[model samples]
Target: MTESPSVITKRADFLAANRGLRVARPGFVLLAQPNDGKGKRYGITVTKKIGNAVVRNRMKRRFRELLRAQLPVRGLPDHDHVLIGRDGGIERAFARLAEELDDALARAAAGKGDPRRRRPARGNRR
Candidate 1:
């Protein structure tokens, strides 16, 4: 099923949790990080090294689609995500994006421990 906006978290939340997923190829890096405890929100990072707005947008679109269709199914539903687009060939193929996304999500999900658990307060420290 498609992920609801409420289920997507933002970038800040993911960073705060110290949870990240990355799959790198010669052309791009696919990354997914959990945001808030609500839903999945995403950010796309493409440097000038890739291309202009047109090219960058294209890459972003690819990543967006990959995440929209497959990411929620594979990775954590409650996380923030950032997909960095590479240059040359990696920018062109959709399958490559799909494959890398799958791999990255798998890697991120491999660690199943919860990051939200609270530690004992200083008063309880012994």
Candidate 2:
């Protein structure tokens, strides 16, 4: 299908949605927040911890493809979503990636608000 209608291009948008609901899966972490915008927008982030520049770019590409394929059918319109790639994201099969994305979106939409689903804060060790 054609590329998703809108993309989250501005840094402000990302910051604005930072406190939104989150869904974490083995492959990726999804942050979703409601927006007043017209259509769905998305962003992908792959941190250096995941790998070097090439690896990060590859992860972003995979996330982009997932968004393009799934957003139209399963994404929430008027919402902003950011997909953060994790260590296994690149190595995971595309089909499984898509499946996880679908499940994450569904959970986000349902607003289940599972406290256990959140990622634990990193603790400093002396």
Candidate 3:
């Protein structure tokens, strides 16, 4: 797929729409929210905690491919989706990853009640 149709290129956009809905699976975590514009925009986030730069980049690549293949069909219109890669993402089979993404999207869209879905408390640790 072309870059313009499948990517969410701005940090501000990601954060502003961050409060929508989330779905977690063993392979990845998906955060999705309604967008103000048309089409589906996506972002992939692989944190340093997953691995070194090389490993992180590999996971991001996997996510990009998965999104490219699945998003157009499974994704909702005018929504921004951020795919957070988990350590297992790199190892999981592509088919399984796609299945997980399908399930996550469905659950997120259905607005399943997620008990652990609240923001953390803010306070001084010390």
Mind giving the per-residue lDDT tens digits that candidate 2 earns over 13-122? 88776778888999998888787865888988888999999999988988998998888878887889899889988899999999999999999889854454446667
> Against the true structure, whose lDDT is highest?
2
Give the number of the best model, judged by TM-score. 2
Order candidates by lDDT, high to low.
2, 3, 1
Q: How much is the lDDT of residue 75 in candidate 2?
A: 86
Worst 10 residues of 2 by lDDT: 112-121
**Higher-scoring candidate on TM-score, 2 or 3:** 2
**Model 3 C-alpha RMSD to native:** 2.8
lDDT of each: 0.62, 0.85, 0.80
Q: Can you tell me which runs of candidate 2 are displaced by over 4 Å?
A: 1-3, 114-126
What CA RMSD would candidate 1 show?
9.2
Model 1 off-target regions past 4 Å? 5-21, 89-91, 112-126
Q: Which stretches of candidate 3 lie over 4 Å from their true place?
A: 1-4, 116-120, 123-126
**Which candidate, 1 or 2, would have the higher lDDT against the true structure?**
2
